[model samples]
Target: MKYPDLFPFSWFKGFRPESNDNLETKSPLRQLADIISSSVDQIDATFKDRGQKYPNLDAPFDPTTPAEATALSPEVIHCSSLIVAACAHLSATVNIPTKLLFDVGGGFHLSAALGVIIEGNVVEILHDHPSGLGVYDISAKNGMEPTRLARLLRLLATHHVFIETSPNVFKNNKLSSMLDTHKSFDTIQSKPEDKYVGTSGISALFAHTCDEVMKGSAFLTETLTDPDIGASGAVEDCPLAVAFKFKKSFWEWLEEPRNEYRMNRFMLAMEGSAKLEPSDAILRGYQWGNLPPQSLVVDVGGSLGHIVREIRNAYPGLKYVVQDRPAVIESARQIWEKAIPSISDGSVVLQVHDFLKPQPILDARIFLCRGVIHDYSYSVAKLILRNLRDAATENTELLIIDTITPYACLDDNQARVGYGIMGTETLPPPTPLLANLGKANAVPYILDSQVLVVLNGEERTIGSFTELLKDSGWKITRVFTISGSSGKQILAAPV
Candidate 1:
């Protein structure tokens, strides 16, 4: 069987038992395996030492029992999963010669190039001059050191971001071409005299993730161990806040005028994520067509009315009221005016309202909150839910669109026995694979950590959600999955 060149590790071809004889050898593969073994051993020791520190994460690993049969806490299981992912990444890095160095160096060069490209419009210049520009000329135009800039471009060329045809000439490729600002507007969000220029949505997301998110993540361990913040559930005490030494919450910090550019990038990142994920899942998975004509739907904390607009386009007869913060609502109104003409006639109503406050809209047919609750801790989440509940009539339906975390165990029975009421059911994988789906669930697991680091929030298990809704005077009725999406539409009603 042929495997992609991107992953050249022979172990990925097929699983085979490791020979005892190779353990003592010093071959590249053996060295890689030894490194992984040593790393796992170290991690195991660390977990054992600190296990008592976090009672919530104290799940023992029983080698005597099969992995499929053993029960692990979500925290323990998630940490173990990360270790496994790190080992795989290390193995791949070591097996592929120069890959490790290239990746590290590429990140530095790419970050530098991104700064220059965004400020000097380097990509736009390259787009116009496809024949290629001399290194000195390009460097001079961008106000950079010629030799250093040339080396950076050459390094990026190895990854196909640019092409270095000769000693000093360079031209953009498909990857580098994307950074070019193609829009007619001079500044982000079309704000006149705004120095922070705009780029494509995806490009903005990449820049935001690489420059901001990664910087905050670098201090994760320190943040997690801080006495004042380690166990705090407040969003203001999260890892990102600790790393940045901020007195305000993440959202509050973003609202500052100095961070307008960053806020725009963050918005674009969310928009890009919505495009990639199945934003249409809620529209299609629910019984929207069955609703009476002119039925009202309230979008709670809806940002820029993106999801609401999509729903209106599909079901024109239904009406929507999008509620959010005052500033956000004003921005949404402007966006709707330009992109959604129906807003003027009240088909789409933009209202300024905070979700934590009592929901003023009462007796609406549906109260939809997408990608909102996950940004909050359980206490805040309950408040938001309770507010909706107070405003809800018997006929009102509550729809929460978010990722539902799955357990690592093979069966619901084991999960129940191990985690009791906190455990949700998990499907078994095919034979020879780990019961937890291993690398298949990496993205969601990582996203779970991201929420913790950024907002002291979390992705929830089905059991967790059930418990949460029950406390808020609501009960989950159904969970709808979308094809090719990691998100789920959870339907509930007031109990």
Candidate 2:
């Protein structure tokens, strides 16, 4: 049985997925594994930092009251952090003049915040522990003032992360949705009827647009909403990349902190989402025939061309063309030319084309898009799909690789950043919401709501994607699974 896409989704209880190991259903186990991994120490230190006596190992995680289980209730703290992150997102919404200054300031604050969150102390521990040793103990020994810690924890709470025993208690109902990553994804894909895919978890919904997509909207939502924050631009500047508005002094402090780990974590967190959908996995096993011969794949916005390069090498006769924004394509062209002479010669064409506009190549048999189309307003993706459809012929194959939210009508209810709203020409209309967004498919509608709040765009579900294709003039052939439970390699054709 598939979980239905229901609003105010409540998978908290009485929820089931068609497949027992379905990632959405199975992730809690994985999270438990990760929590138990090294984080147990972090949890231990957290209790120490909070001055709570460690619970006996055999003690049940059950705490009579939320405050009673500090060590056992890391999840509660995580739930609280969701609020802090949500509110903290406002740091980016300032006008370029401010954004220009704020990111540098914000970055430092965030780094400090992160250190405090992870290690329970904000001293030079992260760097001093060159071996990454037990610096948590060292920091604790050195002495962290109580008043400062309280203030810092309070700041963290503003981001929506609340500490269990802290004097501060957050009241935001919505913050719970975004705190636990697994819960957040379920909420994003949940429809009005599917409690499993309910709206309670906001993390995935927040991730789609609110948290990482853009600076403005994320920051503005928090800033405008905050009572103490000084004047920020009116709400209109929320999503724009007006990063130059902040002070130069802020930028000066910000330049050095842009490290590799930070860049990769934040970047991949936003783009290569945790939920690996079947569509993405399916792209892995396909027979490309021969490579370095014909351009077998066009990876639009394919970052680093890692996937495309793999496909190219796997089938030496087939060549690859990585079409992305100017920066990405140009960078790829130069990097490949230097690394692999063959790719730089002529086999790979790193062209610049916006998916929201007309697709540059229509002749390729399989036109593949993975983790690309979900980055914009729905209206724009349709334009891109419409272009692809207009570019296709009877034999031309359209391979759209992305996460497909569990089909709402079916009893399946798993949701992870997958929106079926690409206008893929089939699967449309389960229900509607809001006067402006109109009726959308189960997963797409939820993703759309997220886009409205966070980054001003969304992820779609299979049904919405089908509808979108139809709207843009295409037809769905099959929605088949690949390796990952969350992803799918969607097959469609131009009508």
- Number of the top-ranking candidate, with lDDT as the measure: 1
Q: Give the runs in model 1 whose Cα sits over 4 Å from its true position.
A: 1-137, 146-180, 183-199, 277-282, 337-347, 405-442, 484-486
* Model 2 lDDT tens row, 1-495: 111222212111211223434445544434333323333455556667777765432222223433354522424333222222222232223346675576445744543553443333222222233233232243354355545655664565555444223243222122221233332222323431222132222223233233233344345455445564323322222233223233322212123354333333334443334332322343454445532356556777676676676666656667667787665677677778787788746677778887657777767777887765655445667777888787776766677766555333422222322333232222221111111112112344554444443333456666667788789887777665432233456777778
Candidate 1 lDDT tens digits, 250-308: 88989988887788777876766666554465676778988899989999998788888
Q: Please name the candidate that would achieve the greatest TM-score relative to the true structure.
A: 1
Residue 489 lDDT in candidate 2: 64
Worst 10 residues of 2 by lDDT: 428-437
TM-scores for the candidates: 0.67, 0.48
For model 1 the local lDDT of residue 127 reads 63
The window of 10 residues in a row where model 1 has the poorest summed lDDT is: 1-10
